[model samples]
Target: MGANATTLHPNVASGGAYDHMKLNNGIKYSFTYELRPGSGSSWGFELPENQIAPTIEETFASLWKFAEEIYADDNATGRK
Candidate 1:
């Protein structure tokens, strides 16, 4: 994927779904991903058709890695 990444804290007062799930519903893990056009493209949310496959592939890879790491940690800690 090799994409630049950053973490954002949503405004609690905004009461977005992620905030509600994490703050009110006792869900410890939640994320919001904004998959925008690559690098210098000004397309914003409108990803071009040509980039769709690559974007999906990159996102899938990232998710897979995240799951693998979480599973490994759970195993190491003996958490079911």
Candidate 2:
């Protein structure tokens, strides 16, 4: 995917489900994604219909990469 990626550390505490799962369930591999239209677009959640397919494709690519890395790490560490 050709999307720009950055790490966001918000000042405010978001008591979202990801936080709950990580804090309570000991799930270390957790994430929260904020999907928006590509760089110069004025759209937020109101993504244009034409942009939907590309967004989904990019999201799937990123997810696949993440999964691949995790699987590789598990195999290297002999984790099931």
Candidate 3:
């Protein structure tokens, strides 16, 4: 990812797991989500590099799933 694309959060400004795809509108996009340090429900996604960014609805859906999985894993491991 480029500097601009990777500059999502001041702290989470770099590497993470990426999910990429081309939307029906022909716009290619990817988002990277990484957990913040310590014990809390905090995460962030990188900015899409395409001309058209994903909509708020799309972003929310993706983030909700990502957070749900993390929460599940944490609960499974008794890491809360």
- Highest lDDT, which number? 2
3-67 in candidate 3: lDDT tens per residue? 32346554654433342223223333344543233234242233344412445556678789878
Best by TM-score: 2
What are the per-residue Cα lDDT tens digits for candidate 2 across 1-80? 11112234344444567666766798757786667664567786898899889889989999999999999998999988
Per-residue lDDT for 1-80 in model 1, tens only? Answer: 21112234233234367656776787746666667564577897887899899889989998898889889987998977
Instruction: Report the C-alpha displacement of residue 4, candidate 1, in angstroms.
Output: 16
Error of 2 at 13 (Å): 4.8
TM-score of each: 0.64, 0.69, 0.36
Cα lDDT listed for each candidate? 0.67, 0.71, 0.49
lDDT of 3: 0.49
Error of 2 at 1 (Å): 18
lDDT score for candidate 1 against the true structure: 0.67
Q: After aligning candidate 3 to the native by TM-score, how far in Å is the CA of 73 from where it should be?
A: 0.4
Show where candidate 3 strays beyond 4 Å. 1-54
